[model samples]
Target: MAQLSADADAFGPMLTIEQAAERAAEHITAVAGSETVPLAAADGRVLAADIVAPVDLPPFANSAVDGYAVRFADLAAAGETRLLLSGRVAAGADAADVTTENRAVRVFTGAPMPAGADTVFMQEDVGLDAGAVILPAGLKRGANARPAGEDLPRGDTALAAGRRLRPQDLALLAALGLTKVAVRRRVRVAIFSTGDELNEPGTALPPAGIYDANRSLLRALVTHAGAEVVDLGILKDERESLVRRLREAAADCDLILTSGGVSTGEEDHVKAAVERAGELAFWRVAIKPGRPVAMGLVAGTPFIGLPGNPVAVFVTFAFVARTVIALLSGTQPVRLPGLPVRLGFAYKKKAGRREYVRVSLAPGPDGIAVARKHPRDGAGVLTSLTETDGLVELSDELTSVAEGTIAPFLAYEMLTG
Candidate 1:
């Protein structure tokens, strides 16, 4: 599991969102070294080693069309170069008879080019007689012929280790006749939420109770990140059960995440249970909606204690969770593409802490751009984040920005799957 050692210092004071994120990335323990998994099951899985080309791609010079392969020098004349067609070669057919001097060969797409042939002329561009295929005038000297080793040479590293396998990667491996490949095992993450007052959706709320959306939302984010999410179900405010469930989940999960009982004053038992079972490190973030996000470990499993507030939970998952997972997987964490756009409205930042202002995007004079400030309030509000295009990254260094000042926008699309 990926939890930090007790040697890591706990959060001391109020931390800026960036500082909290950096701390989580540094302190969380990794889920051990990577191990190889089958290629059939490796899609979206992180790679464990570099894939070197076992053989030269295409293996040999091949035809890229169904036509005639001919010598370039032999086709210098304006009229057709009536060279004898030594033999026909379709894909999968090995050349039985090589094209002799100044001769041509009838070749199909993907077929290995014959000796003495420098180019291919499409069949439609050439005329065929009893035993010879006539080439058209001006047929280029080297047309439609893919040279051997043009794509890759043997012993070359075609794909770097730690590279995520995309569809194209799979296709390339298939072309190389590889049935299976080694990939990093998927990190298993366990997720849930806490609060005796919380109920799953579809259940009638008994007054003060709220819907348990954190577990589902967090589960989706973890799975979409190429992890195996073990749903531990929702836990109540009891410390013993919380500790028991955490111990159970830690047996097989690399990380454990919950959405409540993190703040120092919370009577809820998640924080207490973490301290009892393993470690509890809290970071009081300085951001608006995500300030209460927490981090720690439970029974050796890296623990992510997001605030019960929906918006805060999602925001913290994006900034902090992604960083920790990327570090564990040895994958480079992807920073959201922050595009500079003029704020349609004015916004003030908390003097010493960076803030994320949700904003809707619109087409500006140049191209796609974003507007400023939506509901800058409670973490429970999800509508603003959903309605807006992204978050406006208001740096702590800047106390305020005018209506027309350009500010960097981080799209919500970049945060979630």
Candidate 2:
């Protein structure tokens, strides 16, 4: 655990999204240990070391199509050239047994190319004349023939360290004959929600009580970010109980996460409870839906407090908590790439604060994507997330956007693992 900036004034009262992200990255570092797991279970786990290829991909030259393997020199410059059938090679068969002089060998896809064969003519492109095959002169050299090491050469890096393995990465490792891989251990996070008004989902709600959606939302978001969750359930506004839980969670968890009770409301007790346990900093990030995000250390464990609104919780988790988890899990952080889309509706926002507007996309008259704003703009509207394709990001410098404006859009798929 490294010492974070204790002076809140050093970061100022308000920070940009980029500045907050940089501060978190500077303070919290990857502390996860490494473990070797079988390839089948390695998906979504970050690599601990680079994976070097042990052998050349497609170790031997092979045919790319079911065709006749022939030497380029044996074909005529124009018209067609007929060659006697030498031998046949199917997938998994040896090509050394074929005779290649002034003759063509029948080859199938993935079959090793016959010795000295430089080209392949698809069976449909040539005619067979009584135990011989006719090859067209126009066929280029090495056509339909796959060379050895075409995909990756031996000793080359197959995957880099810090890469979160996907299904396709698993295929590449499997092709290199790897059964297991070394990856960073999953990050352990203790999560909970605050406010006595928050009730369990299964229990009946009191007059002023609503079911706690943030806890379930946080759990899913944390798990999707590749961190294990220790659910602490909901904590009331009592400072003593909150302090006790925070200390206990920080003792074993790598990160502590909570929703609500971080704002400046009189009833909010999480801020004081965190101070009793450890250090806490209230960051007024220039972002809509979520602004009063609290971050600090609880008994040496990093802690993050997201907003109470469901939409705010989703937005903040995607941008803030997601980055923190990536760092703690030893995974390389990747910025979510946004796609350019034409705005179908006009929008206005305050300057110096980044805002994410929920939008659904549809093809316009010209077949280009047109982003339409969600009907409701409330921070607590969960349907704004479920019914939309993604968010239209409004930068801090931009105050207004007119219809037909080209905006950077981030799809929901890009935000999740």
Candidate 3:
């Protein structure tokens, strides 16, 4: 791991969320290398190159329904027209042997259209008279017929580079006859928490010790962001131990992430430990619940320190670490857009800092969804997250919001996804 240059001091003491995000994007310029993988294993991996179609989708004109294929010009304009039954075409069968001039060909769905037949009457929409097929009038030409390349044309780019492949993307690649694709390697994240009062779960608690929750929270979040997590457990609030762990993690991980010990408290050794090992910058972001966040490099690996509070850990990670992960993983960093919903409760906040209020939704009399704020505002309230549907994001300039006002709401699914 080589340290990337991040002049964090240039931004001053406090940074807006947008400024911090931009700084991360500018400083973290390196991406993981790519590898070729089979299509079955490509899901959730970011694409390293564009996928171009070698052949047109469908490859040929085909019937969209089980019906009678006919020449539109041979049908009478105002009444039903009967045509001699000449041939039949089933799916996967060639249409070269069928002669279809003024005659009808029985075609099943996905069957290649017979030469000179430009229209199809669905089997349910026609009748049979003796050995002839009768089609109703007013059916337009090319009805129920799929033209070649209608979906994707040959030589066109089907999937672009930097896109995270989904299950549907695999189906498209398979349709393009691709057995393997080039994808960026998964990012390796080294995660740990620092605090003397923290204890592992499933163990008897000491007098005033609390269970460690941030590591498990971060592991799931890092994995969901398409990275591999190297859990380092909890580091005690000691300068030497913190420095040692930081150095060790930097040797093998792409990013070193930790929770707590980055604030101004005396036990906050992460900032000093990082400075001792490499470089660090404390970014006091103008956001509620997560103001004391830190970013830097440890022995050349990128480092981010989240706040101690569980809610703060989640918020900071969603906005800050998520971007770093995207950059390191070679994927496009897309900010999930907030959905607009009406506020059911009034709220007040300062003008300079952004706020994320936990809220639950209910349908109002006007048919619009209403967002009600949670009763607790403490950062340490873990139930505030589990009990709310999402967060109502109040912008930095917003001073107050009245009942019935429309506000931007970010659902948990959107944040985690």
Best by TM-score: 2
List clash counts for every candidate, in order.
0, 0, 0
| Model 1 regions lying over 4 Å from their true place | 1-29, 32-40, 64-69, 72-100, 103-109, 119-144, 266-269, 286-288, 339-342, 372-378, 404-407
lDDT of 3 at 397: 96
lDDT of 3 by residue, 1-417 (tens): 535555667867887888878877776855658999999999888999999999999899999999999999899988989999998999999999798999999999999999999999999999999989988998999999999998899999999998989899999999989999999989999999999899999999999999999998999999889899999999999999889889999998899999998888888999889888988754588888799898888877899999999999998888888888988887767787888899989999998888899999998888878998899979999999999999999999999989989999999877776
After superposing candidate 2 on the true structure, give the runs of residues whose Cα lies further than 4 Å from its correct spot: none
Q: Rank the candidates by TM-score, best first.
A: 2, 3, 1
Error of 2 at 117 (Å): 1.5
Error of 3 at 301 (Å): 1.4
Give per-residue CA lDDT, model 1, range 1-417, as digits (tens). 554546435566677766766776776644456766555767767777788888888899999988888888887578767777787898988775775467778789999888778789988888778777777787666789998878888888887876767678888877776777877667787888898888889989998988898888888888767777888877888888888998888787787778888876667577778788887676566766676666677766777788888888878888877777766665656776688888888877668776777788787887747485675556787787677888888787788888888888877767764
| TM-score pick, better of 2 and 3 | 2
For residue 298, what is the lDDT in candidate 1?
72
lDDT tens string, model 2, 1-417?
Answer: 744677778888888888888888889878758999999899989999999999999899999999999999998888889999998999999888789989999999999998899899999999999999877778889999999999999999999998888999999999989999999999899999998899999999999999999988888888888889999999999999999999999888899999988888889888878888998755578899799788888878988888889899899888888988988887766786689899999988999999999999999888779999999989999899999999989999998999999899999877877
Decreasing lDDT order of the candidates: 3, 2, 1
